[model samples]
Target: MSGSPYAPHTASETTAMLDAIGVDSEEALFDIPESVRFDGEFGIDAKSEQAARRAVASTLADNDDLTEFLGRGHYDHYVPSVVDHLADRSEFITSYTQYQPEVAQGFLQALFEYQSMLVELTGLEVANCSMYDAATALGEAATLAERLRSISGTRVLVPDLLHEGRRGVLDNYVAGSDLTVETYPTADGNVDREALTEQVDETTAMVYAENPTVRGTIEEGLDTVGDLADEHDALFTLGTDIVALALLEEPASVGADVVVGDGSALGLGSAYGFGLGLFACRGDRELLRQVPGRLVGASEDSDDRRAYTLTLQTREQHIRRERATSNICSNQAWVALRTAMHVASLGPDGLVELANDSVRRARETAGRLDELTGVQAPVHDRHHFREFVARVDQPAEAIAADLEAEGYAVHAVGDHEIQVCVTEANEQALDGFVAAVSEVVR
Candidate 1:
């Protein structure tokens, strides 16, 4: 008999197994060093399922529900009841990748719609169904750019103001390749056009710029950047958020070769480590084939009825190891499904209104904060989307700590700079947020 109550084997069976394995005891199975091995019993006591659930709930109740004004990449948004209800269905929640076309048509179709919506939003021909997040999508784009035989360069140009997380991921992705990542200087939160033009050459493989930079400054001269890429035979990659895309000009109109960003803003809430990555490219077959992850397509079945299936699966698991485009094994299908359901529930006009309202609230909040004695609002003199930076006289960390004490959460980007985000979900909390800031700095 095993010592643990949870063990399945009887004493005779355990002895027989150990004898067959030529081991004296169960502890002999592991080659762990005795010095590092745990000697004490586990503190957790066995309990009923209901008791365990209540204990977990009680522990979680200790956490504070702070008002969020923080958005650099992940954002908090209004999730409609329909989105949660539809996504909570057992068939959708417990499902994995739709490898089999016959059994996964429903999920495949939902992902197809997700791709279609991204196509319309980005003005691109093809869109992949999934990616890990915006950072991974951008990293994948760097690798995809390297695949272009016509471009012989091994360098990727990124704005100096790019998000630290994104830059870190991009660095990790290109570490195995011969690609070199370099930065182009920024002028007032926008990529410096002159420096960008100077940096692009025959050795550059891609040039990436974020629409609303990490500092919440809207990037201008996108067409000029695209032209520079075209001149150097480099791919121009644009990174942005879905909400910003709804209010800004379509990426295709500015000659972007690849568009990547977060799709979670559509319906997903901010919980960290969860996001829907949006990846789209022009209708070029070569580009489509090189896109990472799966692409769902519409087709007809044996009965001549419309159907959906996974058309392109270029991940290492589906394709030959040597020919795989990416090693990314899992797709954010559930998150994508949530996004699709949220978008469908809101239609076109509702989405635009949601985006516009966010912009309005952000601008209004920035304007109000500028009136504070020690605050210099809109740190960058450029149009902002849902977030902005404010330069204050006091240390940003101290201010943030003070704000947190008052039930508010904001990001401290610099020594005295704090980034504030406004969304329809937290618009009503702006007044409280401003008052908290005033009290901190006063």
Candidate 2:
């Protein structure tokens, strides 16, 4: 007890616990290999806070100062400064999980608004406050499909162009369940309807697809994809960012049972790996019960005043472990708050304008790149969103490295193909980026 100040047990209590477990000493409880065990001498000198800040700054400065034109799943849409100002307030940022609705009405209301925003965006009846990210949300959707009494089958079909990270996460999620993930071919960056038709059958559980796919091409004939899934009694899940959801076809209209994507695209501005997973599904009672993450609901208080509270807590932490909808321990509440602030600041019309700009910027940028010799912009024939693939005469990796040398960064997606993403955030640097690309490709 003296040695372990954090441990609650006294010497006799500890001995009793160890005796109950049939271990003579605490050291025997750990099975760690002696060779791999920590020797506990990290040879690092401590530094003052100011000195540490300077050291971190110096290390970060070593990174190349290149304008990134990179986007696959993560995007850097310009976030209004107002979003930061309001969302950073102590009340919003410091609030943890709102278990006590009486004290946490403000944070809960903000989350309710976030859910309402997603509800309208996806045209779905119900929207959870948040999930970990797009990958986890998709994973949750697959499990929901399995849980739904209305749907059946073990096969989860996805587009061939799904982001590898998301695919990997989804694979890890379903590895424990009876579900198996399979890919269907894409035609020119869009779902191949004919090939998809052959793949969908009685065995299909859920059909997952993206609007502007990982290649940045807006999916065509998406309604047909939805229809095909409905034909086989399979659930249709559509993925799209918050901004794109403004201008693209509504997921519900396209027959999507669930809609999941990164809500952070509009608010966070390229928080590279971190994201706010948007999860919404049709409002059917059965579906709502099966939805993952927390849902904030609006209701009347004891005084008959409108109030907000964390409604359906389907996480294993809050409910019976076996009865929980998901084992996800926590959520991106702060990120969701920022996203809601960003969306509210934009309003409906501003959001649509921003989304329109994404389409225009992608097309115009592709057209400019196409004019350069040895570069064919927009390798895909379909309409694009904020990014697109360009075919270059030189090796893609070498061209990307050359572009980096010229103070620009783009993804070398293939042997001769590079994927470029441009939005209002990087629109100011387009001229310099195109000039650099011209020099690199030449």
Candidate 3:
């Protein structure tokens, strides 16, 4: 509908409007308090379009064949050409907000498929279209955490090993929403389950944590936390890397009341580009009603024809603002479709094989690295997904710098740990990575 939201403004009209607003120039409108604004714009010269392209190409000229070795939250994976081709189909690419529900059935149906995929993956009773990403989804989940509880359950518990950015975003979302946010400390870069239990009580709204934590160490025994939240009537929300769930236990089976996670590992190219919302629950009917975003349902039209349509979309943008469950009904549909393709490409059995391959490769990589004189993951012993953190003899960042200089792409995750991510497409790269790491540490 917003074919061009800014089509009303012409260049000359914008200038005239600025002048009428009493600003000397467009730049003058940016005049902020000096304490907040830098005096200079870093003095970078602008280039012509052609010159810019050449300059950008030149910057990357020396690095055409470098193998990537980094995997913190994002990793390199094989995406089907069909994924892009299908997502770019005019039916999906040209559409937005299918409000009429009839004329917009194509987009709505694609979104419905996306939602169904998430339900299958998460094993929850229901999954909506999506949210901004796993982080914002968690923030929304935090709000639901409070709303799901009574006055006694007012505090939210976060694990020490939760992704820092996700935690910060959660804090900001709930700052004015009347809930206390606190992080449980870790024992060895992993959330201390004992500490988590000690703090969570009747006053706690949700016990939020991750497995295969940001520290690259898996947090054990969430069954205990779920039991605790049960006793207190609080929700036990497990945050996770969705792909890891293929190799690890599903949170539902392991005692989580709510399952929230970023599905980027499914196919998101980078952490910031696109995000997947992994939402599931213990399948409570009342609990499912309050869940946010788009919901797709398999239904029969009045004529008794089978169809899929957008279901419980209570987003403010779709419904009355006061009655809206979330303003995020239109989340990651195209992206979720990509995730679905990746998952469907790897069928349930295929997913298990991929998961096993990743776990084995990571374990092998750790074992080989630990054999080196100065590289090891001190915290790695449990089964892992594709990524694992290894402690180097020197600071991990410095070692990473050295590795990158040698045309390697390893990422530093902590003061002393570098992460290695293994995938089906990166076997040769992984071998080169191990050899390169050997030389660097040696």
Give the TM-score of each candidate.
0.90, 0.90, 0.82
lDDT of 1 by residue, 110-169 (tens): 999988888888899988856889999999999999987767889999988788988999
How many collisions between residues are there in candidate 1? 1
Q: Which stretches of candidate 1 lie over 4 Å from their true place?
A: 1-46, 314-316
By lDDT rank, best first, the candidates go 2, 1, 3
The lDDT of each candidate is 0.86, 0.89, 0.72
Prediction 3 global C-alpha lDDT: 0.72
Model 3, range 164-196, lDDT digits (tens) per residue?
778888998788677888888877656676777
What TM-score would candidate 3 get against the native? 0.82
- 2 against 3, candidate with superior TM-score: 2
Question: Candidate 1, residue 365: CA error in Å?
Answer: 0.5
lDDT of 2 at 76: 94
TM-score of 2: 0.90
Candidate 1's error at 399, in angstroms?
Answer: 0.6
